[model samples]
Target: MDHKRDKEAVLHLYNKILPPLAEKIYQNLTEVTPLFDDFHLEKVVDTWTKDRNTTSEKEISLENGNVQQMGLRLRLNGFQAAGAQTFDLSKDLVFLLEYSTYTVGPDKNTRWLEKPYLESWTSKEMEETASRWCEEIIDEITQKLQTL
Candidate 1:
């Protein structure tokens, strides 16, 4: 069986999902409540990476159709000024997080522990599953970002 098709299909699913995910994360950060009176959420740096932040050399490689790693690196920083009425660009790194996804298993919870190999699902099925998982991840990440 040609795994190339499966890899292509999986990559396609991620390609469609990543942009909106990044946008949602950015949007959430924009709405964050400052922890201090003068604290500001000045700059948000978000980028999509094919590399796995968890690994050393295997940072970027799609081994088999299932063992793929992709993530969004988020850097949000702000500054606290003495009595600033308005917040402007300042570098006071508040939080940095990378939300990663692994297409390793059928169950979301057990995905990391289980060995990864692409399931032979149709494109539509894969799309639905990937969308659902991304939604869950987005919600979780958004909440965490807001809380920070």
Candidate 2:
């Protein structure tokens, strides 16, 4: 299998999906309960989760990579229905994309933020992408709001 393709597919998945998904969330929320706009769509709580397992149990080598994942963090709080007298809703909209493995030592070359990546993800690159995605999602949300 082509690991390089795997890496590119990962990038595409995040870049193309997150912004629209966020937009949909806001749209759906507004459709269901617009009065709680003051509460919904507050922030994206960034969090990373790790799976303590190797890719293959048969390949129990020290160099084998462990499963690490970056999850989408969106939380809504203080939401209530139009007729609710003493009720609030808080929800976590987390999207776990893919579980990645980081192999030790030199491996194939991958491009991230116009730089090379071999073993693990690039922090700066991922940060930049997240910033861009935030802007995009916000832009979409604003557009949808203006229409409403």
Candidate 3:
């Protein structure tokens, strides 16, 4: 397989699929938690051959709250080229979600109360499957965050 072709295919997946999905997940999270209003979900695509990865991140800092800082990271991986005449779904794709929180200190420094509350991965084949997987993951994350 041509490395260039494979790289292009990966880039295509990043540009075409991941961003919209990330946005949808972000939207869902925002709907469930008003704290999400203080932060923005950022979708980053790193196509560098040696470090090919896609990530979604959100960080928020609040002045006088139990949760002074919250960070969320989602990594997208396991991309593979489909066989001829096969549907191009993110079947091989995996999403790793990590959640972090910090507390405000007396000196106005943020202390790591809980670095990661949740860490999970989701894998699904086909467009619909992948979408449902993402939605479920987002729902879980939202539920987890509400307790924070």
Candidate 4:
């Protein structure tokens, strides 16, 4: 698991796995009608981490009036280690979501409200965690949207 191999795997996950899954999620959300009329799936380009390594991210968002109603982002971070004659590499997938509403205060100040959720999973648990978390978030959002 050299850097090249590690990068390749990351690319495979970013390019091969996420796009179709995001599309499926988008399609499902669309079926829910007005709640998800503004929902969109976006491919975030490569981003540099604090250590200067590259990471990939994707986002799904629903917007209302000039504000973000709900959003979810998935980011992948990779790492590598070298032994005497061996190499080990791994990655973590981080999922983030913001569930929020807006409020106008008595003083006439507008405030954007939010409840944030974050979860991280290792490469070995990527598939299970991704599927489970995405479905859970979608269900929760759908329920919440129906009330709005």
TM-score of each: 0.32, 0.38, 0.32, 0.36
Ranked by TM-score, the better of candidates 2 and 3 is 2
Model 2 CA deviation exceeding 4 Å by range? 1-10, 40-47, 54-74, 80-83, 97-148
Order of candidates by lDDT, top first?
A: 2, 1, 4, 3
Ten residues in a row with the worst lDDT in model 1? 89-98
What does the lDDT come to for candidate 4? 0.32
TM-score of 3: 0.32
Which pairs of residues clash in candidate 4, taking residues 3 or more apart in a chain or in different chains? none
Clashing pairs in 3: none
Where is model 1 more than 4 Å wrong at Cα?
1-6, 33-67, 81-148
In candidate 4, stretches whose alpha carbon ends up further than 4 angstroms from where it belongs are 1-5, 52-131, 142-148
Across residues 1-148, which tens digit of lDDT does each residue of candidate 1 receive?
3233234544543455445544444444443324223422222222334334345443232333233334343323343334533332222211112122234322323342221223333455445544444454446544544554
lDDT of 3: 0.32
Query: What are the root-mean-square deviations of the candidates from the true structure over C-alphas?
Result: 10.8, 12.2, 19.5, 20.8
RMSD of model 1 against the true structure: 10.8
lDDT by residue for model 4 over 1-148, one digit each (tens)?
A: 1222233333443465456545554554443323221333454422322212323232321211111121234321221213222211211223222122122111123232211112222343434434554565556544544544
What lDDT does each candidate get?
0.36, 0.38, 0.32, 0.32
Q: What does candidate 3's lDDT look like per residue over 72-108, in tens digits? A: 2343222122332211111112322122221211122
